[model samples]
Target: MDRFTERDQLIRKWIYAAAATIKESFDDELDIERKSNRNDLVTNMDKAIEKQFIEKIQHFFPGERILGEEGLGDEISLLDGVVWIIDPIDGTLNFVKQQDDFAIMIAIYEDGKGQLGYIYDVMQDKLYSARTGKGAYCNKRLLPTIEDRPLKEGLVAISSALMSKEEGLARTVGRASSGVRLIGSAGIETAHVASGRLIGYLAATLAPWDIAAGKIIAEEVGLIYTKLNGDKVDLLQKTPVLVASPTAHKEIIELLKSQKI
Candidate 1:
């Protein structure tokens, strides 16, 4: 097998192992700490899981660069080499409070090109993965390509905070789509879009690790992923993101322009 194939196997193994460790930690008292604010929290499980993936990556791919959410990876100044973008626990609040709805995400990019993406819904035991030029999958089942669906007929996912702050967005989405859902987990929301469960997902602000893997999987399934202004999403920058079906993507952009959002 080629290098990517080999790495894919390794990643699957590591992810399952990490998931077991995380699940076990739920039985113990969590060491939680606030990051940017009280709402932005981190737990000891997040750090430990990140460390586990980092150690395996370093041992297996010594020179590869890693940009991780937990800050346990390498100091990646550029996306030039083989880079691993990881979010150990995408929805930390859900994991801490509800013990569900969170996900572990990892993306492998070689010289700025996405090679593989993995989003494991740990609580649900669903693994969404995709390889470049290969089809996306939910566990062993292949995900169908996203069919064209008009914005008005489809369900859109957005953050509750964004919905409240941006009246224009709420109005546009409310009027255009069937309804809106606030899942509080970017990875899970993105997976829903990729799997055709949701027509689109819009985030007011998202970090690189938040959407890196989802972007790869979304693109493989023929979904359009871009900034709100229809710009290409930069993997190294945090910005507003929209992942949607082609029809919904065009319609949403038009609505945003009409509202100047």
Candidate 2:
């Protein structure tokens, strides 16, 4: 347990160091590349930051399995042991364009349970983190717990694509809340929910690194995180996701369940 704490501290320091390196690397001349398609993207900084973190993790905790967004880590087909999920840059497009609204996401799992989570808002210099038994925090301050509230009065967080394009998700957003918004990053959206800036967040598609940390930290504040269809989300798979205050989550899930994609 004490060793875990020490390792946790080391990882936090590494996250800060990685963020600093990333901030310095962000320039107008980013080495950007297309992946999957034109809209899907990757950048030199993305790979560099991911490799930096992975290198440190390997140096300190050898044999731990890692699943990174940039494919720099191990390709574990299952989540059966000590594992790390890393999204070196959560908003690569934003990083390449605005250099803001991006995050470094990390999640630690031990024997199939989320043991710890971290989301670093690099530009803002805020680090959000939590251990399973510990409450979530932004920097040193604890995140306020979200109240259980229904959707009609709650501000919703969602992406433009899902709000307008994904039919079932779109209608769920349209009918389940007072408003819908997009911040372009799962880490940012979920961080806002942890801080009570929004009551819920939904995304149509995401990788493990995108939601693993957010899910751990959000649920620490009494938030509910599940798939859009309300199933267990394998932290190792691509899936639709929803995170919300429990009451708000219930409403969103019902709406999603009743609609068609």
Candidate 3:
């Protein structure tokens, strides 16, 4: 197998292992702690999950640096070599409360280019993945390109956090669309856009681990991912992001120009 195929198989194995771990320990009492605020919580499982991936990656692909949400991996400054961006649990609040909307995610990059991406929905047991130049898939079934629809003709999602602070902005966008949804998880929301279920997903700010995996999968399926202002996102810092179908992206960009997204 070529390197992409080899690493693709390896990441699938690692993610399956993670799924099993989450299923096994989900009901147990969690050692939860707050980060940044009470709403930003982290559990023991989060740390364990990230630690597990880093260990497996080191054992199988030593010297490959990792940047995990929970800080279990290396302190990466540049994307010089093979780099892995991992989000152990994409929706910690949803995972802690509903246990339904969370996801496990990993994105592999080579010299700053996205090579492989994986997003595993823990409750549904669905895996979405992509290999650069190849197609995207969910449960091994190929996904179609995002429908090129205008904002008014398409369903879409805006971050709840973003909406609350900018209620008028949310209302404006919603009024211009068929409807609005809040998936509470970037990975899952991006998957929806990739599968043509929604035309767009917007977030005011998201970290590298939050957007990396989904960006690869969505972009491969012909969706556009960039900042609200029509700039490419740098997968190394937190920034506002818009993952949308081509038609919707252009429309949303014009609408969001005056706002501080």
Candidate 4:
């Protein structure tokens, strides 16, 4: 097998192993801390999981750079070589409070080009993955390309915070879509869009790790991914994100323009 194939196998194994460890600690007492704000949570499981990934990456792919959410990776100023962008626990609050709805995300990029993406819904046992030029998948089934759906007939997923703060957006999107959902998990929401269950996912503030893997997987299935202003997403900076079907993407852009969002 080629290098990517080998790495894919290794990563699949590691992800499952890590998930097992996390599940085993579900009932254990957790050491949780706040980051940035009280609402932004980080648990011991998040740190430990990131460390596990860092150790595995270092041992298996030495010299590769890792940009992780838990500060267990290198200080990467550039995506110069093989870079692994990881979010050990994407929805920490859900994991801590509900023990579900969170996901483990990892994206492998070669010289800034996304090569592989994995988002494992740990509690649900659903693994969403993608390889460059190879279609995205859920578990063992290959996902179909997203069909363009009109915004009025589609289901859109938006962050609850954004919905509450941006009244104009909430009104416009709610009026346009068949319905709206606030999942509180970027990875889960992105997966829903990629699987064609949701027509779009929009977030006002998202870090690189939040959308890195999702972007790769979403684009593989022909979803248009961009900023709220319909601009290209910068992988290095936190920005507004929109991943949607082509038809809904255009419609949402027009609506945002009308509301100046």
Over 90-156, each residue of candidate 1 has an lDDT whose tens digit, in order, gives 9999999999999999999888899899999998899999998999999999999889899888899
Best by lDDT: 4
What is the per-residue lDDT of model 3 for residues 104-146, given as tens digits with 9 covering 90 to 100?
9999999999989999988888899998888899997999876
Q: Work out candidate 2's RMSD over C-alphas.
A: 1.5
- Candidate 3: the clashing residue pairs are none
Q: How do the residues 22-113 of candidate 4 rate in per-residue lDDT, one tens digit apiece?
A: 89998899999999988799999999999999999999999899999988898888888899999999999999999999999999998888
User: How many residue pairs in model 2 have overlapping backbones?
Assistant: 0
Q: What ordering of candidates by lDDT runs from best to worst?
A: 4, 1, 3, 2
Per-residue alpha-carbon lDDT of candidate 2 for residues 165-233, written as tens digits (9 for 90 to 100): 676666656566887777798999999988888988888788889988998999899999999877888
lDDT, candidates in the order shown? 0.92, 0.86, 0.90, 0.93
Error of 2 at 133 (Å): 1.2
Could you say which candidate leads in TM-score? 4
Model 3 error, position 180 (Å): 0.7
Q: Compared to the true structure, candidate 1 yields what TM-score?
A: 0.98
Name the runs in model 2 displaced over 4 angstroms: none
What's the TM-score of each model vs. the native? Answer: 0.98, 0.95, 0.97, 0.98
